[model samples]
Target: MSRVCELTGKGPMSGNTISHANNKTRRRFLPNLNEVTLMSDALGQSFKLRISAAALRSVDHRGGLDGYLAKAKDDELSSNALKIKKEIAKAQAAA
Candidate 1:
């Protein structure tokens, strides 16, 4: 699987690794991705997602999966996450 955050769309960033010898080499800064199951309060279901640690904190800060998806940009979300977002929206709207 690709090393990307499903929630935040975080990917590896290109950078340089500087050494003590004043040498620089190309390097990649990868996001800290973890597989976690987050529960949606609105949908009352748990969804497994590959997300960064920072995104996890943001989710908790926002409240939960439903709250996080509410403020998330469509472009930043993965297909699965987008589907969940839509379902949550539909459910909340029905209620």
Candidate 2:
């Protein structure tokens, strides 16, 4: 799988590593991604996703997976996450 967050779309960045002698070397700054299985109350199921640490914290801050998916922007989420967001919205609308 790619090094990208499923929810937040966080990806690796390119940068230079400087040494004491002012030598620069190209390096990739990878996001802190974790494969997590989060339970969705609205869907009544648990799904596995590869998300960044920051996204994980934001999900917790937003009050769980459902809340995060509902509030997150479409551009910030992966295709699968967008689908989940739609499901959550539909479930909410029907309730």
TM-score of each candidate structure, all chains considered together: 0.97, 0.95
The CA lDDT of each predicted structure is 0.96, 0.91
lDDT (10s digit) by residue, model 1, range 3-89 = 999989999999899999979999999999999999998888899999999999999999989999999999999999999999999
Worst 10 residues of 2 by lDDT: 83-92
- Tens-place lDDT per residue, model 2, 1-95, is 89999998889999999999999999999999999999899879888999998899999999999999988999989999998889888988898
User: Which residue segments of model 2 deviate by more than 4 Å?
Assistant: none
**lDDT, residue 42, candidate 1:** 87
Q: Give the least accurate 10-residue stretch of model 1, judged by summed lDDT.
A: 39-48
Output the number of the TM-score-best candidate.
1
> What RMSD, rounded to one decimal, does every model reach?
0.6, 0.8
